[model samples]
Target: MNQRAMIAATALTVMSMGLLAVPAAAQEKEKCFGISKAGQNDCASAFGTHSCAGQSKVDMDKTEWKYVAKGTCKDMKGLSADEAKKMKM
Candidate 1:
């Protein structure tokens, strides 16, 4: 292949690979409440204890969240995303 043709082909291949990799990497995670260990949360608390991740002073606080795979949180030992959203906290 010519230089320009080879470059274009390589670019196209890389782009296609990246596109194919996205969904597999996405894997559908959802925020599960009251499941995060101390300092291991995914984001801020719903109860206003902290403003960001990694600030939880206690494990399974019911106000903190951690990302769990979707459809699996309900089966887990903690609150599901929907339940967490409905919570007053």
Candidate 2:
């Protein structure tokens, strides 16, 4: 390969490796309910009141959640998905 082609190939390979690392890192996270501050939650509200991140309107709404490191939710006094489900009923 020409020098330009070779450099591009190397950069592309590095980027692909970074992409492959994302899923493994994601597995290290867990959703911890009732812990997010207003406008800071990661994704869909648990109560179906909203369906996007960073849209919570109240601090620490029990139906709002954000991703916490796996296994640390309880230490943070946050509920698990199962626990949140029960509370919503």
Candidate 3:
């Protein structure tokens, strides 16, 4: 293959591989509440006080959450979305 053609083919192959990996990675993680350190929480809070990641004012806040590996939340003693909501109430 010509130089430019080889580069294009390599880029396309890499892009497709990355796309295929995303869903599989996503499936391997789940949102685990009350596990993140202060200002280290992922994407919003259960109480709606913040709408962005890394905004938790307190460590291990029930309203804040991080994505933990699937089936490991209980092992980490992390709360579910419903459980976190009840704690905030």
Candidate 4:
């Protein structure tokens, strides 16, 4: 292949690999609420106390959420996404 063609192919391969990686990573995670430790959350709280990750001030706060592996959040005593949404935080 010409240099330009080779480069295009390589770029396409890399892009495809990256695209494939996303779902695999997503499949390994789930958003679980009421389980975050103090200052160790993965994202913002539903109640709007914070707008970013790692900002929780209380441990196991019901409004805070973190990414846990699928099927493991309930095992950790954390609330599922639907349950968390219904919970009165």
Candidate 5:
């Protein structure tokens, strides 16, 4: 009985320590925008600086990049290229 209790206590302690690590791991992923200089130029051209400003940019492929629009863009939800251009960035 004592051996079983000790084993359970040890498992609980290990699980608690792992739980404390979750927040730190989540914070590391908070930065959503990270793009190379070339990728930056491409996005700026494709979306235009006014529309793409403050949006998350990422290079999904070596030669291809994307700007992830948030906030106002999210309101529009799904917009075509022309519709997106008309939106306030």
Candidate 6:
């Protein structure tokens, strides 16, 4: 096969595998976090109902609770406690 044809075939193979594997891979890596009832009430008081209400809830102590994110102090989907603490806002 010519160079161009070979490259195209390789690309097609990768694309096909990606199409079939991405969803399963994503599902496997997906994580679930739990929140405590007290934590929910605290969040509700601060951010209101919209922020507190979500599909997952983890029971956490309000005193020790520290919402952190990738690059900010605010609560976000994926954030480390250390990273969030470093964030100014």
Among all windows of ten consecutive residues in candidate 6, which has the lowest summed lDDT?
28-37
lDDT-based ranking = 2, 3, 4, 1, 5, 6
Cα lDDT over the full model 6:
0.40
Model 4, runs deviating above 4 Å: 1-27
Order of quality (TM-score): 2, 3, 4, 1, 5, 6
All candidates: TM-score? 0.64, 0.69, 0.68, 0.65, 0.31, 0.29
Worst 10 contiguous positions by lDDT, candidate 5? 28-37
lDDT of 2 by residue, 1-89 (tens): 89999999999999999999998787888899999999999999987999999999999888999888898999999999899989989
- The TM-score, computed over Cα atoms with residue i paired to residue i, of candidate 4 is 0.65
Look at candidate 1 and give me any clashing residue pairs.
Answer: none
* Tens-place lDDT digits, model 6, residues 1-89: 99999999999999999899876555422111222344342233222323543312444422223333223322333333343344424
Q: Give me the runs in candidate 1 sitting further than 4 Å from their true place.
A: 1-24, 85-89
Instruction: Quantify all predictions' global Cα lDDT against the true fold.
Output: 0.84, 0.93, 0.89, 0.89, 0.42, 0.40
Residue clash pairs of candidate 3:
none
* lDDT for each residue of candidate 3 in 1-89, tens digit (9 for 90 to 100): 89999999999999999999998787878889988999999899887899999989998888888998789998999998888778878
Error of 2 at 64 (Å): 1.0
What is the alpha-carbon lDDT of model 1 when measured against the actual structure?
A: 0.84
Candidate 4 lDDT tens digits, 1-89:
89999999999999999999998686878889998889999988887888999999999988899998788988989997678778874
Best candidate per lDDT, number? 2
Clashing pairs in 4: none
Count clashing residue pairs per candidate.
0, 0, 0, 0, 0, 7
Candidate 4: RMSD to truth: 4.4
lDDT of 2: 0.93
Prediction RMSDs, each to the true structure: 4.0, 3.8, 3.1, 4.4, 11.0, 11.8
